[model samples]
Target: MTAAGGGAAGEVDEGPLDEIDRLDAAAYEAFMSEVYDALGGRGRDLPARELHGGLVEARGAVHRAALTAEDVATVLDGSLVEAIESVGRLQTQLGAVGFTLAREAAVRGLHRDVALSLTDWLRVRCPWLSTQEAAQITEVVKACDSPVTAQIGDAVRDGTVPLHRAALVARTMSRLEGSLDVDQREAYAEIATRAAGRRDLADKDLARVCHQLVEDLLHEAAPGERERAAQELRSVTTRRVGPGLTRVTIDAPDGVAATINGVLTSSLAAPAPVKDEQGQVLEPDTRSPAQRRFDALATTIQRGVGRPGAPPSTARATVLLMIPFDPAGGVPSGPATTAAGDYVAPRQAAEVACSADVTPVWLSADGAPLALGRDARYATPAQWKALAVRDGGCSFPGCSALPQWCDTHHLDHWARGGHTDVARMALLCGRHHTHVHQHDLTATVSGGTVTWHV
Candidate 1:
């Protein structure tokens, strides 16, 4: 055929771009057919990665040609349910690929192109899908062709697992191999599901167990090797030390001998005491006793301060301490005495008594009590109840996590200006709390809505 435009008279009218688009559409159809056939029969026949890659490429072409800013805007403005259904139908017919994969590819470009956030997009377009489900679907598609991804899709289709659980399985499986036979894979998959169900199990523990299962299947090691691996695994699983009760001793730099109990071994440090102008001990710096204890523990851990190379006999005592605020702003109570001279207050004494990791002892400055180990001032049951009521759930916006699943988060931060009052605190799930601190997402509560300023 003769070339048409931008050429001699004999040239054909069609452009290369038009031809390429036509061919891409046809190729995409064929790819879809193959994927459908593979899923209908044994899904193992096709390489998931190759199929996913093709689908993604096809989606790019279709998205460029068929979807428009106007269409997206109209859809977002109109009924989200209708828009999602329409999109789902269009994506479903795009070829014979799995519905999960097709929907993922269709939305992939939309996430970047659409003005509204993808989460919002899903709400408008696929109102039938829960946020958790949408997140899981996205996670699986992003991890295409992996055994875990496949498993997640399978679970969704079978309705045996929730989206979150499926996502966890996919993540765990991605670290493993598809070479595992059906029986072995099923075993590990079941284990993964069970682990996901148990909220108390650490994610690392789940991954480790799944990894061990895969290793057992792939390595086929001798009994000795297996035993060694088991031992190492056990070591990792078991806590190196227990909480609540332990003994630790701090060797003062001056060797004057001060003992405290319920002291955190990790928080023992030998920072030089600040002295006054007259060679008398000035007020210890403003660091909280808790902060000092943590610093001491960190120092011991890093420098191996008091821990001897050889083992010792008797365990050290635990000491507890607390700071009490009087109704007036004046120096409330020192370690040595209250107005009664029977040792500061019962609350402070209790703190000293309960500091279990070491024997209970009070640290005094010139025979005046300074600090005692005790429970945090604000962790009362009533305060926690108020926090739960105010926050409703995990206070992170868009997160509907339950109360039991959350931890109290200080609004201004206790280390900063945040107080222990309920109004200045909110509940956040462990994951979101970690994300807040780790990713530096600024979370603040105003008018009862927790806003995240990333």
Candidate 2:
């Protein structure tokens, strides 16, 4: 039977449908051209609608292609890398534009028209954005509003800097505001953003830059102020991130961090050789580095819980504080610093010296080591006992290790003319003992007081 109003069922005229499709394609082409024009050659000015449209088009194309892993492999290695990088760059560019628009919208009070605040509006309209992400964008927007940091925002919008780095710079700049004037802040911001633009610079490197700046500023602060700041900055927090998983966050000064890292990286913490019950070789450890570190931490904690006043079961490590003194005045020339470069105030150093094996080092005005305290290779039992009495535990800053868990370290290397006398020695934990050697640390003792120089 013939179908009603058609030659056959499921049949339709092709000519008019083809014309309609051609018109739709032309209209889409025109819209995309407008979008590209707005982007200014780098996708930097993509409006929300255009950006969403582009994403939709790309998604549709990807779905239509239905490419397989084999198809992906057909591309040359160089092409694949280039394509991946291009996509990443475009995404970054788009993100920058989004941040810029958010800032503009905030400035214009557009959020008040819809939601209570900018972040609230973003959370409401963009459910895909995580809370952290929305907050970060808001922070970026606020930072961009600052005159000093506006250039960093510009760099982000230009796709020259990543969003994370921009945020980091913003935080650093805020911290440095008390130390730097507007001009100095602008200069530092420029340098930071320029460095951020470099593809070779890692986030950690930028962080180091920020750290160095803070340290430099701290150097100009009073000893009491710096010490107080250091004390305030130290923190340790543990939170459960998932079932059976807890994230431990430790924020400490450079010196304390070095000490903690030293312990975690000690030979005792290294991946042990797997052995059978008969003590025969089995296989190398299969645990990841993180897992090994975790196990090492557990073991260290277990070993640290001996009798309250028990001496070490075995020989431990030693520590030394290197403080530079004026040869003429017999006074400290400046504040002492840890091997990791955290400054040590005189009061703190005095506390460490009372118990630490103290060695005096004399330096000329030009920082040349004119003379060192008596040298030592190893401390005698009497000397060790003296140090243990003098220093209750490890002499490293922020360490509370027991004397029994510490070693008698020579302030100066015995091989380099160091003496092992009680006055020239310190008790250091195994980890800090290694740190002293690795950093070639030195210190000074005068009038029963110890001072460390980085």
Reference-based lDDT, each prediction: 0.52, 0.68
Q: Which ten contiguous residues of candidate 2 have the minimum total lDDT?
A: 309-318
lDDT of 2 by residue, 335-403 (tens): 665555666664344333333244434456676766644433335556667788888777765445689
Name the top TM-score candidate. 2
Give the deviation of candidate 2 from the true structure as CA RMSD.
24.9
Listed per candidate, the RMSD to the true structure in angstroms reads 23.4, 24.9
TM-score of 1: 0.32
Candidate 1 has its poorest 10 consecutive residues by lDDT at 309-318
lDDT of 1 by residue, 202-304 (tens): 6676657666665664467466654443333321112225667444433231112223233443235333468978978776566766667777656645676
RMSD of 1: 23.4
